[model samples]
Target: MAVQENLLLGAKASKNATLTLVFLSILKGVVGFYSGSASLIADAIHTSLDIFTSLAVWIGLKLSMRGSEEKFPYGYYKADNLVSLFVSIIILFSGVELVREALLNIASPVEIKLQGIALGTAVFSVIAMYALSQYKFKVGKQIDSQALIADALHSYTDVFSSLIVAITIIGSLLGVLWLDSAGVLVISLMIFKLGIGMAKDSILTLMDAWLDKDSIERIRQNVGSIQGVKTVDEIRLRKSGLVVFGEIEIEIEGDASLKRVEMLFEEIEKTVKNEVKNLEHLVVNVKPEKISVMKIAVPVLMQEGLHSKVSRHFSKAPYFIFIELENNDIISWDVSENPAAGLEKKKGLKAAEFLKDQGVNVLIAGEIGEAPFHTLRDNFVKLLQMPEEIEDVEQVVKKVSELNTLTAPTE
Candidate 1:
């Protein structure tokens, strides 16, 4: 669901960028043709390429939005990176062509008519480019969208190129033919540099490089803040257009219960999802520490007499006697509770059998019926029988801990 949301946001942004580029390209082309300015014409071509790149981005975003399948379990996220690479190649080729044309015009310059139509068109193009650049910039930040960022760069370059053409047109009206071609050459170089940068970014994303150090640190801090988590072992991040994929490893106590670990992971995942807008994937692994021994308290259920008997027999071992009174009241022998008012067993010997199967070492009670006694003895449970009149449950616990004998006769 999160991935779908991010993809939808990216797609909407891409569509807006595409429409802006198309409109700007048409406006620039009309202005350049009427003015007969070579630089203006070159800017129009660059704007056209922006339109094409935006379309590519839209298609890539759509493809990358697909959910994972058995054949492609990781989804189509790499599609966006590949499309960026394609866009870079297109930009590079267009830049080379523009440079070639500019060099030719430089060698043999053409006179351009600096008419009102041309000047007015350049003004309109400049305004549109600036507006689109700002929009793209704002949307890119909101979505953390790489495609929109690229579109913003394209618009920014268009603004600079349009301004240069405006200057060249003004210079040409004053009879400076060289200025027009020179501006085109400069624009070509800027476009070429942008192309190279986009190519490098695409390749790096395809190679699955980690995200920035600052982002990794931030994720580590957030994950470490979760309760029960001891430390963050590692964080792996990858990008596909606007989406971010993260895999985290956290260290927790070896003896921590599974429920605690799951809760910690859930908290971290939720924090990252809420904090990072474009987070599409998160995987968490908990590594436990090695330990030689683990001490855990095990609960046992038995009647009052059987509890006392086990407590007396295993007096030297650590144990607690739980007595079920007749009224469904759970009175612990470890507490000062009367044996006569012991709680009734809601589930009978079945419950004790279940506890025995769970590896409980001792059972303390006042008395047990024949059926339960035979069951406990068969399961090798050390039953300690308590006095019927004894009211202090705490004393029963101390007595059992001090006496170290077994209720079951020695084989």
Candidate 2:
């Protein structure tokens, strides 16, 4: 779904939650006021505060949808985090207020009038708030709305608060007047814990903390496996309010043309976004691989050290020598027999795949068929030919080193 639509849905969900809290608060307040139950009154007040927090969520979701990229390049994603912090503060203060009222009542020893209505009202509020909190949590996580989640946490605390009211009312019925006062204290501590946790999460999100390690590693593996990506240099991502923002630096395919590079960039972006959830914006940097030491492959008819004669048929070659040269100096050489020599069909394709796996950048062959020519060229393997007089592998290396655009291959 579009971000605007998602935000609109979030706003709708929060609005509904706010309306529900208003009703629940009213129900609890009327019951607590007549019964003189301080615990019930405190639960009612917490529900009232949830109403305001839910309104904050609605406003924050609306603000997050307003895009001002020209004025604020990062947009208004932080609006949700700000709302989360605000809701947490309200919750914290509510907890403190509840605790104060509870301790004061304990010191003065106020009498609580127990009735069937008080217990029934608290039980009803508990069920209602539980259902509402679950709804908010599901929607919040579905859309990844921080403000909505914070509000959901706030509402969830209401379930516990109402349960405390039920317990206190039962204690009052059992002739323990002081039990109602102590119940509110437990409710206060639970609310305090939840508020602190929520506040810490909101602050970290506002600070643009680094994304989880698993996500980073997933992006690295995905981008690295692309056909045109040589290396994944760096991946940096951080969670904004509802989305993730990041940049990835990668080395482009070997000797890729401009058009090819563009395709690689698109592939990398598509792959990373598909792999990572909520990744809305990504910057891809494609750098060309610097050619320092390049490996060249030569087809030979014999296993002789460096004097193996060039094979007329590429796929039928008995041995292939891989020569690594840096700045035109032979650094190392290894010879391996061509395993595709026995393939009667698709021999050229098999040989090309083998050389490609062997890290051959350029193929020095005497005669290359049409199939292998396109296959090798598509893989960024340079196709070059030796003169008719060059029959040995040593001469082949010398000719390849001096070969340039002047003596390029011809069909």
Candidate 3:
């Protein structure tokens, strides 16, 4: 929408330039005919061409502004390029005619009348062309309108060409007859170059060429800066007249949820729109990448015989396990897979006293009831309950240790 608005603004500016040039061309033509000055006549003709080219630009802009249709799905954006190409050809032909006339004048020089009037008109035309060219150039850059830029170039060249003619006319009045024809030749060459440049640019646009490398790189940097985007896989840009359409493919972490990916997409769109002035359309696709998860061992304190019970049901037991001593002191206690029942009561009391003294923070066991759970909780010992039916003490112990690590307090 912003792109469309800018295009409209350019169209309006072009229309105004056309109207002004047409009025100036009529005035110049009347004066040139009365003065019989070839240079003024040539200037009038160039202004007339500008008026015609401006009309072409206005038509092209109007057509390009139309919405997409069934017959032409991409809309009429290329029409502007086509008009610019046609204008370039016309300008080129005008240059060729001017050159031909210049050659003839060089061969058979004629004294032109009203040198003062011709010089004055050329000076006024230069001032007008300069003002109009500056206006078009400024707006063309702002809106990214190639047609407007081409029109501005035409106006700029006219300013130089008219100034050259003015100098030639002044020289002719000073009896330097050859300068007039030489000036025309120089102006012809400049106009030819402008025509060729405009034509080449229009052809490039019609061919759907990509934008500049720097522009693509800037877009890549902007999209990559978005959070959750791991990398940019591919980017494509298509130019239609002044507007640009972009397609971007990005890679993101596989573990990143759908909501996160959506946020990244939104961010990318906003970033592109804000950064690139002529960006008309954008499509974003996200590709996910898989990552490995690492596992680590964690220590946890449990009631004495609790590990034994868990070991009896499950295969694994905690490593570097600690228990309370009989005197309520904490101590590292190791128990084999199968322990004798004779030491059960002593071990349980010792484990409790040791945990109490060491300030063992949490306990994990299988199926502890509310009464015992509350007792552990009141003692400031966090208890985690596991399912009683699951045997395999090794697996249970590993799972309990993993959970404790994840929820453990940091020092």
Candidate 4:
């Protein structure tokens, strides 16, 4: 959904929660006042605080939807987390107050007025807050709203505290007043722990915690799969409320034209958007990849142009040298009539030296001797074999292109 619509839905949910809490607090307050039960009054106050926190959540969600301005270029996405942290602080204070009140009552031993109405009211509060917490939690998870989640947790603590109040009332009725105080203490500590955890999570988000490893690996795989992308050099992702912001650097072939590079970048962006979820903002930077150029030399016995017939002899007396380049285009052609081509002593070495000196990175020939093979291998030249039946220069080039073992020279 759009940000505005999502925020509107969150506001509606928070408003409904606020109204429910207000009504429940009023009912509990009326019962506590009639019975003069201090525990019941404390629970009522907790519910009223939840109402305020719910309102804070509504305000935060609404404010988070605001667009960026000159003063705040990144928008108000962090407002949601800030409000959540604020609610956690409120919860923490409430826990402390409850603990202090429970300890003082335990120490002084005030007789709690335990009545059927008080117990019934406590039960009702527990059930109501439990239902409200469920609703809030479900909606918060659906929209991925952190403030709503914090508010939901705050409401959840209310349900537990109400349960403790019920126990306190039951213990007072059974003349075991200390159990009520003990339950309150336990409930307060639980709330304190939950509040601290929620606050820590909010602070981490506000500080821009790094994304998980799985997400980084997924980005690398998706971007690396794009055509012309050599590698995904770097990936950085950070969470902002429900959205994710990312920066990536990818490498492509250096010889690509500006138009081709632009198209590749577009493809990378589209692919990432399609594969990743909740990516609100993405910055992709492209770098050119370095690659080594291959220069292939083929000995040809021809009577015509570049596509002429191939020669089967490696140390032939007179041969036409066809140099192939990266795109299978010929760079040059020369008639190599080396006198060492007819020599028996070190003829293969001499021919290999001649080809190497011509700056040939790869040699395509038919039936090269062992001596020339070692020479080519030592000189870091790749060799592909051509059969005698392959008469055309094009056929020799095709054979070399199809060769899989470019690391080792072939006879």
User: Model-by-model lDDT, in order?
Assistant: 0.69, 0.84, 0.70, 0.78
Q: What is the Cα-based lDDT of residue 219 in candidate 2?
A: 83
TM-score, candidate 1, is 0.68
lDDT by residue (tens digit), candidate 2, 282-375:
8887778877888988888888878878886778888899999898788999899898998889887789899999989888776667777887
Alpha-carbon RMSD, candidate 1: 11.7
Expressed as tens digits, the lDDT of each residue in 338-396 for candidate 4 is 54666869877888888888777787776677888888887768777666566777666
lDDT of 3 by residue, 232-311 (tens): 88988877877777889988864556688778878898888776667777888777663232111112233343243342
Better of 2 and 4 by TM-score: 2
Which is the better candidate, 1 or 3, if ranked by lDDT? 3
**TM-score list, all predictions:** 0.68, 0.71, 0.68, 0.67
Ranking 3 against 4 by TM-score, winner: 3
Give the Cα-based TM-score of candidate 4 against the true structure. Answer: 0.67
Give the number of the best model, judged by lDDT.
Answer: 2
Per-model root-mean-square deviation over C-alphas: 11.7, 10.9, 13.4, 12.8
Worst 10 residues of 2 by lDDT: 402-411
lDDT, ranked from best to worst: 2, 4, 3, 1
Candidate 2 off by > 4 Å: 294-411
Candidate 1 global lDDT: 0.69
